[model samples]
Target: MKNKRKILDWMLLIAWMILIFTMSNQPANISDSQSEGAIKVLLLIGIDANSIFGQLANFIVRKCAHFLEYMVLALLYINVAKHYFTKKVVIISTVAFVFTYACSDEIHQLFVQGREGAFRDVLIDTCGGVTLLLIRLGISSIKLLKLR
Candidate 1:
């Protein structure tokens, strides 16, 4: 049973890495423009229509998808890490490391011709991680309550 989980964990980790690589290498023009424009429109209608708000909205719109993607990856990785490692420390350390790796990946995009890395995007990405973590935690708590 233990060995099975270990294998699954490694497999999941590998798949996650492949996804990260694919996302990094994906063509940006189509997705990027869609994200930017959608956010702009949402901001224009949702916010006060100020330029700053528009820009902020655009930024969030542009990066939120990536953030959500990372969040899912992180959650899955956490689950896999928990399976392979007995200690809570090991699982948490892996999450932190994975999160840092995500930050670095985004930073790497900055050097790409069409990509610009921003701290705000990292923050948004972290929010995604936290959001998913909270959701999963909530689900776990609910399950525990039911079990009790």
Candidate 2:
């Protein structure tokens, strides 16, 4: 049963990695269109979607996608690492893995037509990952205090 759970955790991590790669493989135009549609939804809810605001909204949506994707990836990495390491080591290793993968993901984007790798995106991704890890640790610490 323990082995099965460990396998499942690793499988989930790999699945998320594939999903991120698949998204990065999309053409720039296609990705932009998806973000535009999301922005339109925001407009429907009265977001003042004027020309400038519309563009800004689109930009925010795109960056948030990067943030959210890596956030989930980091969470999954933590789960997978817990199977093999102490809690402290899991936290450190998960952050390192997420950061390395974020860099690689940007590099992968460089090969996609109409997409160029940006260090800014990598920083954004890493921030997302680390933020999630910190939040998780905070919650765990709170729970431990409650148990005392």
Candidate 3:
């Protein structure tokens, strides 16, 4: 049963990595079309739908994707790492691994037509990982206080 749980965890991690890679492989135009649909929904809610605002909305959606993908990656990494390492080591290693992967992911995008690797995207991804870690720590602290 324990082995089964471990296997499931690794499988989930690999599946998520594959999903991220497949999305990164998409060309900019294909990616933009998905974001444009979300922008249209925002417009329906009465946000500005002018050309400039639409472009800005697309940009936000893209960055948010980066943020959310890494956030989930970090959470999964934490869960896996906790099974193998002490808490302090798990936190440090998870951050390092997630940040490194984010950098590599952006570099992968550089080869895709109409896509250029940007360091800013890596930073955004790192922010997402760090934010999740902070939230986890906060919740743990709250639980400790309640126990006392």
Candidate 4:
């Protein structure tokens, strides 16, 4: 049963990484269009996506994309790590994996036409990973408190 669960967790983690890679592999124009699609969704909610706000909308959408992808990546990695590692080891392993992959994803972007790798994006990605990890830890801590 444990083995099956671990296998599932790993499968999810790998699938997510592949999805991230696929998104990053898109040319800059395609990527921008995707972001624009997201903004159109926001427009439905009455968010003005024009003028200076247009630029801001694009910036927010792009950065949030970076943050969310890695956030989910961290959650999946942590799910797998918890099955195979002690608490201390899980933290170290998740951070290491998330940071390394974030760096690699940016490096991969460099090869894509009209796309440039940014150290800032890597940092944002790592921050997302850390954010999710901290949230997980907080929830765990609360569970422990409840058990006491």
- TM-scores for all candidates: the values are 0.68, 0.92, 0.91, 0.94
Model 2: how large is the Cα RMSD against the reference?
A: 1.8
The model with the greatest lDDT is: 4
Cα lDDT listed for each candidate: 0.69, 0.90, 0.88, 0.92
Which sequence of candidate numbers ranks them by TM-score, best first?
A: 4, 2, 3, 1
TM-score, structure 4 vs. true? 0.94
Clashing pairs in 1: none
lDDT of 3 at 144: 100
lDDT of 2 by residue, 14-130 (tens): 999999999999989998998888777877887755455645777788998999999999999988898889988988897899889999999999999998899999999999999
Candidate 3 Cα misplacement greater than 4 A, ranges: 41-54
In candidate 3 the C-alpha lDDT for residue 82 amounts to 79
Evaluate residue 147 in candidate 2 and report its C-alpha lDDT on the 0 to 100 scale.
Answer: 100
Tens digits of per-residue lDDT for model 4, 1-148? 9899999999999999999999999999999999999888877888767554756788788999999999999999999989879999999888899899999999999999999999999899999999998998999899999999
lDDT tens per residue, model 1, 88-119: 66546655865686788777777666776667
- Model 3: per-residue lDDT, tens digit, 1-148? 9778778888888888899889899999998897888677867887755455544778887898899999999998887887789999989998898889999999999999888899999999999999999999999999999999
**Cα miss at 101, model 1 (Å)?**
1.7
Worst lDDT run of 10 residues, candidate 1, spans 47-56
